[model samples]
Target: MDKPKVAADSPAQVELEEGKKYAYCTCGLSETQPFCDGKHMSTDFRPHVFTAEKTETCYFCRCKQTGDAPRCDGSHKKLQEPERKG
Candidate 1:
């Protein structure tokens, strides 16, 4: 499988509406951050479809490494830490 581009090192804060469906950019090639802009059509990646159960502010992952789709799971923090030098 091809690796996705890194959209951001952190999450994107977005306001979601209840009962609305959103397509998350798994390819990270979208001009729209954290959202699919149909840029993954040529790639092996597919957008993650999610429906909001309630209207609220949510954090979407831009790192493309989260086990949880579309949402931030603090996985980006692992990349933020400085590596220990031997």
Candidate 2:
């Protein structure tokens, strides 16, 4: 059996700015990842709200398979790690 794959266009992404609020995407269908692109019209998913207090970047969950919604749970690392060398 093949491992399940997550869509490339998953609703994952996050921006950080001092005292700034952003609307994140959680439907994995948004044209804009981590942002509410109004693509949740056809799905039952809703946009998520996030705030920042510093100029930083955050990893949003693009797989939608994370137990921690709207955040990455090292899932990307699994896909990005290099194969072990002997």
lDDT for residue 10 in candidate 1, whole number 0-100: 82
Measured with C-alpha atoms, the lDDT of residue 83 in candidate 1 is 22
lDDT of 2 at 13: 47
Top candidate by lDDT: 1
Candidate 1 has a TM-score of 0.87
lDDT of 1 by residue, 1-86 (tens): 48887778889999999999999999988989889999999999999998999999999989887888888998777764442111
- Clashes (N, CA, C under 3 Å) per candidate: 0, 0
Using TM-score as the measure, which candidate wins?
1
Model 2 global lDDT (CA atoms, 0 to 1): 0.60
lDDT to native, each model:
0.85, 0.60
Instruction: Tell me the tens digit of each residue's lDDT in model 2 across 7-76.
Output: 4523344557988887766666665665678877766777788676687777776655566756777655
Residue 51 lDDT, candidate 1, scale 0-100:
91
Residue ranges of candidate 2 with Cα displaced over 4 Å:
1-5, 9-14, 76-86
